[model samples]
Target: MIVDSLDIQKEIPLWALGDGEKVIQREFVFENFKQAFEFMTLSAEYAEEIDHHPDWSNSWNKVSVSLSTHSVGALTKLDIQLAKAMDAFASQVNSKN
Candidate 1:
């Protein structure tokens, strides 16, 4: 489906996938930098597998990721899928420690 940017923004934090109108944001917190980095690595792997990239930053134990479908001008299934993948990775990492 051609997920419109407007439709995606209407569902903030839940389905809003992408930076601005094209980026999805996900914040992950961990007990320490080691754990945060671990999650980042896993997330990187997932991004590579799908060939969908994210803009992210790491500050101590917190990591923020933003996903955008640059090719599409707005949000799409790829963006949503990537965001879900990131959430899953964060959940798995958090559960481990």
Candidate 2:
């Protein structure tokens, strides 16, 4: 099931509540293009492993991600889980730099 917008906003402040065509969205900025691309690559692997993917774009040092469950026609737990994973990955990458 898709989580309530209020709950998602409260859970992930870094992500906008109603972005991504009324789904959840966030932009991650890294130290450089290499770091940003690496984050995307890593996130992609994880997304593939979980069978959940994010609609995302990368430019220079920023990655814009929009997460929604197309199967459900709304944001579901899978979206939240992937968002959290992306957040964690970003944190880890930041620490490495």
lDDT of 1 by residue, 1-97 (tens): 4576665566445544434565667688888898899888998898899898888899999998777777876666877777777777778888886
- Number of clashes in model 1? 6
Q: How much is 5 displaced in model 1, in angstroms?
A: 6.0
Model 2, clash count? 0
The best candidate in terms of TM-score: 2
Residue 27 shift from truth in candidate 2, angstroms: 0.5
> What tens digits encode model 2's per-residue C-alpha lDDT throughout 1-97?
8688887877787988665445888999999998998899889999999999999898899999998988778888888899999999999888887
lDDT by candidate, in order shown? 0.75, 0.88
Candidate 1, residue 57: the lDDT equals: 98
Worst 10 residues of 2 by lDDT: 13-22
Candidate 1 stretches with Cα past 4 Å from truth are 4-20
Worst lDDT 10-window in candidate 1 = 11-20
